[model samples]
Target chain A: MEALYHVAPFTGYIYPNESVVPWTVLIVIYPYLTGLVAGAFTMSSLYQVFGMQRFKPVAHFAMLTSLCCMLIVPLPLLLHLGHAERALNPMITPHTTSAFAVFGYAAGFYVVLLLLENWFVFRPHIVQQAQQRKGLLGLFYRVLTLGSYDLSEKAMSYDRKWIFALAVVGIPGAHGLHGYVGFVFGSLKSREWWSSDLMPPIFLFSAIISGVSLLIVLYALSCKLRKVPIDLDCVKGMAYTLWGFMMFALMLEAVEFASLMYRGREGIEMILEYVKGPLVIPFWTVQLGICSLLPVLLLSFMIWQGTKGKTLIVGVVTCAMLVLVGVLMMRWNVVIGGQEISKTGKGLLTYHMPWVEQESGLTAAILLMAPFVLLAVAVRLFPPWEDGKAAH
Target chain B: MENKVEKLEEDGRRKFLRLFGAAIGGGGMAIAANSLLPEAAATETPAKAAIPAIPGYDWSQHHWAFGVDATKCIGCLRCVEACKVENNVAKDPNHFRTWVERYVTLEGEEKARIDSQQDPVNIAAAGAEGKYRFANRYKDAKVEKAFFVPKLCNHCTHPACVQVCPTGATYKTDDGVVVIDHTYCIGCQYCVQACPYGARFFNEEKRVTDKCTWCYHRITKGLNPACVEVCPVSARVFGDRNDKQSPISIFLRNNRVTVLKPESGNAPNVFYVGIDKEVG
Candidate 1:
């Protein structure tokens, strides 16, 4: 018979109940997906709100990415819950003091904002397709038109105004939603690893970098699939954004870690031991060294050399892919790593992730990929490419 | 220690609860007023309604506390077994409501070596996951100092677990016991992560977070907690501090007790005596 729970193996003297780790890899994916949504929205805002012409090509696509990612953000949490049906209890009678209680409202509000923004942005396309096409696909577009076929200059301007307003509101909405996720971990005074004032900002900065990086990769992939030329200027703009934010993310993380060590509180010794022994590969090697530092250096060199065309696209995409991995590792370090060091302050435990189970590594991998699947189908329906007919 | 101070604390807690209740009520009203459905206001809220009413228990009339005398603990494992049986806790080495830790400082060693009944060697000695025993691994070594300390939920005055519970399913009663309404808990385990003492754990069987409730059912029925009742050496102490003559009250008065992780600011209700500096 299968065991009811996975018991983490440990050393030293952890409280006996500490043997079973509470949050799993699924929890790690929760913040990662939310960060992507926030980050991608940041990219779209660069074009829609900030009026950065270079970002115009990918701005609509970024919004679509944010919406798709936001739609799937609740899955990991739902799957991790023991009674997923009762998940709305937090929203129904939210405990005002609890950080986790705000999630339902925050996520719900952001989803509505994203949906509204996407509708305004795509209404022109829906009207055009509704008039021109036939059969089931045409009916789908027609129904989506919401009974208004006005493509007048006045209506287009009205739609643009709504798009700009929603994007403006979404700046704080998206970032606040992700920052709140960081607060969920940071405000916990229990574990020395997560308790930090710097957590929210750090998560915010990392989210920006990860989202920009994701946009770079997705844009490049889409161009390849469509046999269109990759926009070097657009990719460069996103690369610069990624480079700038990655520095802030790296510095905040370093400062947080240094402060934790310098404070040298009661559990400092055990934390230091864990970092040197168990945290070597995950923290120092992947998160900091290869993924973070290497990407920053590569992007810097590309910018300095005035790199252009395929070389620049390859460089920017490479850095973006590395950053995506780096942010995921950061989430893993914050979520799973916090648990590995027991609250006892005298012990450490190793979380052995299950390969295939309800909340297993496989489930987490699938959840992470699910947004892209939706994004693919959504991009087909909406067609966010610049070469496609512009709605506004 | 005085009734006046206790009254002030209780009053303060009541004020906070009143404010919290008002905030929820006000928010619910606003939501209902904005909602399209007229019947939305009539839908029952799950959290406040879920608190089970005990027939004879007056929770507000008493202040409960627990005490652990480390010096008196013999590591007999009786309290551990009794707790599991009485509470129907999972019969496994990992899931324990109460367990004893043996801290042994060998001669010339700077730190004490610690292990509980869950240690693999001890489980091997006991011959089963459900059983409990402390392995005699240090018998050959020259021991300088050794002692056993029993551990359980502190039922903290400012419980991190209760504060972090999203659904307010876990809450502190007026009598000072932290209890969970299993029916309302969403099973997110945020409380389990928030607890600094590792007191909380996700009950896979129940599909909700679980911990030592100080045997709320037994205490309300005028019986000692199962572990306290089964403790052969009187290491585990339990009673209402409202009665000055109660075991916990007298125990607190007699001992220079300290709590685990005072820096965590949880202000744990569990008092410990004869514990070493490294006990936490």
Candidate 2:
């Protein structure tokens, strides 16, 4: 039952086991998706904690987006595992020293915190909606309330206090959630392509960038769908922040690469050959040229002297979409491109994503969209666009 | 009034003491609960129950290690064949518990030519007449030196694979061979990525990460590993490293030996004799 693909030809020596790359495109999606969760959560905090009143309309939407994405983050990981049932072992009996062991703890902590914060923010609204609805829908909202019927001013004030505390704690918790993913790649001393101290911070910054980009795109799409006017200030503010963070992330990556090149490390030549070989397309074209550079220019121009109406919205949306693709390309390069070069420095390994296989690229693409479907369901329940609807 | 105030102070001190005691007790219980979980989860397979003790030999008394004398290897690949038969490994060239590499370098050549006997499809195609053949792989007129270097899992004392396994699915045994508990493996492939020697592979058929176990099942029963037993030139050696009488110990003491990628600090149990610098 071998998947059909040409074994990538290799020159020089490669140990036999390395001929097939074990970590596939699904693993790439794991980190990329987790980054979005972290980044989007941070955007929500910009309004809740930092008091960025311009971001008010999108704050709840951003939090819901982050939660929806976070819920789906573990799916790709579970799908990639050879024995999915044993995934629970990490939570029950985690290997303390292993970097991956933190996945369970960090993800659990963040998910619970997000759920608590969501409850705090939406409790009063749920209580109100509960009274208006009937039958099963009313029962659903009632269950969600957990029998706390207090919609009083005092109860609302307490909820606000809790929300503030959770948001503050969540800032670093979000960083740890994504930063731990970076540590998994960075701690592997075996592969020279990933072994960098800069990987954690670099991942964190890119996460925030992609996250903000995703929010911008989603927000724009939502406005267009519901016939609501796009919040110009929100879009402009996010554009400026997105450009700044993307530049910082790009600089970090450049510095990391430059330092490695300057030192002429032992396995750097193999990676150089990889950059010349099959890696040229994703590494140079999609990740750097289209995704990174194009978005940077588009956003820079827009941020300097932003236009209003459809033109500004289109520009922001385009750049946001580009950055999203670019961030994902970066993840793909890190996970899959890193595996293309053999650790022995003698040759390259190749991978082709089979269309029909469960772990194939097609399946990964479908799995990536699952979160949006979940987000649709979440939107119905929480109504992230309520404020925007009222303004309209 | 003074007596009443003294009573109030006494009551506050008692409440404080009780809370402190409860906090310490709760903390102690949490620590105890944490330590006990991994112990319960570390249960070995029932296969260990069926393993018989070696006659008059205590398994705990000695440490095991492997050694390879590269100078003695003849590139016959009998060990590769034997290992597949013994372990029920797939017949595909991509799957191997042990494989042999041949390195050739002509005089005045700046680079060495290295080839491992993987890729069964090419091997079968070349030997269409039902006989194995390598068509003039070393046809250079100025051949300086050629040697066969057999490789397997080094079973390192400080194994990187074991260190990176998220669920502790891959672990080092007390007797020193690193083995994977296939049932428990999530197969995230982190262990495969961590291995510097590229000894680990995901078994496509079984859907689990597989590697050389140094024949733990056979060795514990006082039998040589399939590779060592089938080596016609005595190139592969396995024995108790603690015993001076063992062939591995004698070879290590007598020869200038090296392990692959010594800079990795894995402290491989497998030692190679007369190994070229080009070997991984």
Candidate 3:
């Protein structure tokens, strides 16, 4: 019979149980998905709440994207649990002190908020389809209408109020949920790498950049598929958002790293050693140099030169893709890297992620892609595109 | 001291009665109190009727503690084996309820070299995943200083594990032991990451976080933990700290003992003597 658990190989002295890393690749996916949800919601709110004209083209699409990502946000966590069925136990008998206990309630509230906001945003399209189409698809849209066929000026104004209200409330709700995800790691004093006051903000900023980057990529992809004229102003707006937030993310991360080194705490030697050796490629080269710095430099150059049209599109899209990879690497470094350094402060452990298993690389990859698949179906049904008319 | 014990028992009774009254009057209040005030949740006793009653064990009347004398330990591996057998812990080198560490300072070396039974060399020496033996790798090295430090869960007064358990499936008992309600645990392993000592592990078979409970079942029945009972050199000690004459009390009185990672603020109950600065 095979071993029930994958044992991490280590050097020096680690507690016997430390050989089996408690968290896995699935955890890396959890925060990444959450960040995308928050970022996408922020994009939608720019138009819905703040009334930013540049974001008008993608506002509804952004909401649909946020909802799709938010719906699948819990999958990685559920997959990681040993007792997935008992996942509700935390919500039912919450230990208030635990940062994790609040996750169920927060995620549930955000999911409901997303659904309500999505319903109001797509109501016009839903009403149109319900009146015109006939068949199973029509029945689905009618059921989705929730029996309110009122597209009157009064009803629309009321719906607009509700939409504005939900979007305003969602700004904090979405970001707070993601910031709390950072707190889950930062609050733990056990690991030197994770214990820092800067963690929450760092996570929030990185999340914003990642979400904006994802929007840039997705928006560009959708235009290509639909054969519609790409909205240059909308793309520029997202790029600016990504660039500004990326600066904060990079600075906060640098300060956090600098402080950790300056403190020269008990385990500094081991941390320094681990970073210099094992972290060279992942931390320095990929995440920092290529993914982070390259994108910032490219975006800065493009903005300075007043680049536009195809060049601007290519430049922004490339930077966004780099930022996306950079943020994923950030999540990996925080989650997996924190575990790699032994809690003993005297050793380091290497986690070998299995290619195929219950909570393996394959599962994580599939989960990362699952949201986009749902987004495709959601896009088809709701028709978030500004150019597309309802089926009537 | 006797007066103090009586006072504690009286306080315990009063608190229990208040909780019991609230429980009887409205289950919602107890649940509300539990979720709102973490101290109440931490100290809430397991319903007595739910457990199989021990003949005369009253958890409230006792407070347990453990002590380790590093100087006396022989690195025999007996305690490690005994703990696994007694607890039915996972029979593997990686999962241990209790294990011993060998810390050695070689000639002219500024730092000590450390390894435990889970080390690859030690596992190779033992020749089986279920067995444990420290390798004689240092036998050919220059003479210096060495000692074995036996380790287990501290069963801390402010256990980070219990504090971070999402479902309250793991908690500190009234008698001072931290245990998991295996059936209720979601096995997210947040507690495992929270532990500074790395004492907690996810039990694959049971699908819950497992750790050294200080052998709560056996200790409540007036028996020592398996590791303490089987230590040939009497390195491991266990007794109720509430008892003035208990072995742990005498050990505390006789030795200048310290806990692992004092800065962690865990207030670990596993007091140790003759451990070097590098032991943590």
Candidate that would win on TM-score: 3
- Candidate 1 reaches a DockQ of 0.31
What are the lDDT figures for the candidates, one per model? 0.88, 0.79, 0.88
Runs off by more than 4 Å, candidate 1? A389-392, B1-51
Q: Model 2 residue A312 lDDT?
A: 83
Which lDDT tens digits does candidate 2 get at residues B33-135? 4422432232332224343355765656668888899989988778888888899876666667888887878899977777777644337545642222234
Q: How good is the docking of model 3, by CAPRI class?
A: acceptable
Q: What's the ranking of the predictions by DockQ, best on top?
A: 2, 3, 1
Candidate 2 TM-score, true structure as reference: 0.90
Q: Estimate each model's TM-score.
A: 0.92, 0.90, 0.93
Give the docking tier of candidate 1.
acceptable
TM-score of chain B of each: 0.83, 0.77, 0.84
lDDT of 3 at A15: 82
Candidate 1 C-alpha lDDT tens digits along A1-392: 54689989898889899999999999999999999999999999999999999998999999999999999999999999989999999898876667777778778778878987898899998999999999999999998876667788977897798799789878988998888788889988999999999999999999999999999999999988888888888999999999888888989999999999999998899999999999899989998998999999999999999999899999989989999999999999999999999898999999999988899989999999999999999998898999764222
Model 3, residue pairs in steric clash: none
DockQ for candidate 3, please give it: 0.33
**lDDT of prediction 3:** 0.88
